[model samples]
Target: MAPTPDEQSRTRTLEGVLWMLGSGLSFVAVNGIVRHLGTELPAAQGAFIRFAFGVLFLLPMLVQLLRRGLPAGTLGLFGLRGAVHTAAVICWFYAMARIPVAEVTAIGYLNPVLVTLGAALFFGERLAFRRIAAILVALVGALIVLRPGLRDLAPGHLAQLGAAAFFAGSYLFARRLSDLAGAGAIVGMLSLSVTIGLLPFALLVWVPVGPVPLAWLALVAAFATLGHYCMTRAFASAPLAVTQPVTFLQLVWATLLGALVFSEGVDPFVLLGGAVIIGAISFITWRESVLRRQRSSAVIQNG
Candidate 1:
């Protein structure tokens, strides 16, 4: 007999939690690698190597795709997502080189809020009042973290902001493609496209580095591959609603890593701002969950 709905939901929730944890750790590891590389490697080179290695790591998935054949009508969407993701990777790598890991992670939380707004505006998803309020709150939190007027923001900060926006676009495209393509295809395309996209810049800025940089680059590939794998597993196990909040744990891990590994100090404003962002994200997650449950309940009732 098939499992009951409640049992299935519970199983999915547990799996999602595990996946989110893996995602968080993978991201932290990526950050660690970036920190380790520092200025030794150009950001573009780092981005290129990271994606190139990621493609190699995902070769098994590609083989499966070859066996199954590509999905119909998804290449365009995949290409769009890949392009946006390539932009995000470049910005994120640049920011990582210039900013503290914890700060970058904190600022990166803005992506979810942006995603919510994008879904509402472009996808015609209903924008609940609570979600709107949450977005505003999160924006304020971002401003606090940025402290725009009080201090000059670095070019890296702006790059990170741009990255967050582009990442939201990538997510939107991915969500659309999810209906037509397997996750493997999405990951494969992303890795391949980003590697290709970064090639020119990587070549232009190529530095003849020693083995240490190459080692760090390889580590970056490993971390990103694992992180994405864990993320894919999480989504497979549970709905996005359940898995989303678990991602916030990344900030905590990043903070610890930044402080201990890099000897980077966190500012009070960053903590306060991060708290606000977390609270807003939590609110958004809770609201979305409630909405999803209500819709499901209604559908069941009608059935």
Candidate 2:
């Protein structure tokens, strides 16, 4: 016999939490691998190999898509997203190689802030006062993370900031594509497009290293693939408000892994700044959820 409704809901909630945890852990693993390969390989080369391996891992899904037939339209938007994401990956990989893992992770939280700003500018999404406050708080957190006056700014930090903006654009385009394309199609197309876009740059900067770099590149691919899979599962099962908090666990995981695996020392400021950023993100997510619920309830009542 099938599970009761209560049991079904409980099962889904458990599964969603597990998926979010797995996603967090997988991304931490990816960061660890990137940090390990940081000085050993060129960032562009690492980015190329990572996406190349990601494409290979998604081959089965591509085959399945081929079997089902491709989506008829949206190739233009797909290409645009792929290009934006390609740039983001390059910048992100460079920052990973150049900066402390924890700092890069902390600065990455700016993407959500960018997303809110992007929505208002591009999609005409309303900018409520609470969201504006969250954005301001997040900006302060970013400044704390950067500490521009206290420490000399590095190119990697700027690269990471640029990458965050690119990622925000990618997310906006992705939301559009999601309506017309299946998940597999969107993912597969992204992998293929990014791989193609990165190839020339990878070739230009290519250095021949032996098997160690290859192994690290392979780990990057594996962890990222697993992270994306878990993220997809988590979103499918739960609201963003429920699953988003779990992602902040990545900062802790990154700090610990940086210390234990790479012998990188944790900065106290990074921890403090990351906490603020995470808190801001949690508030933004909660507010978005409340607004969504209110809108939905209004619709139901009106209908």
Candidate with the greatest lDDT versus the true structure: 2
Q: Show where candidate 2 strays beyond 4 Å.
A: 1-11, 63-73
lDDT of 2: 0.88
Whose TM-score is greatest here? 2
Q: What is the lDDT of candidate 1?
A: 0.86
Task: Give the least accurate 10-residue stretch of model 1, judged by summed lDDT.
Answer: 239-248
Candidate 2 lDDT over residue span 1-303, tens digit each: 999999998788788889999998999888888887776777778888889888888899888877887677788998899899989999999999888888889999889889989989999999989989988998888888899899998999999999999999999998889899987798898998999999998899899878878887898888888898899899899878788877778888888988888788988888788778878888999998898899999999999
**Once model 1 is optimally superposed onto the true structure by TM-score, how far is the C-alpha of residue 127 displaced, in angstroms?**
1.4
Every candidate's CA RMSD: 2.8, 2.1
- Backbone clash pairs for candidate 1 read none
lDDT by residue (tens digit), candidate 1, 60-134: 887787688778888777777878888898899999999988889889999989999999889999887888899
Error of 1 at 160 (Å): 0.7
Model 1 segments more than 4 A misplaced: 1-18, 64-69, 235-243
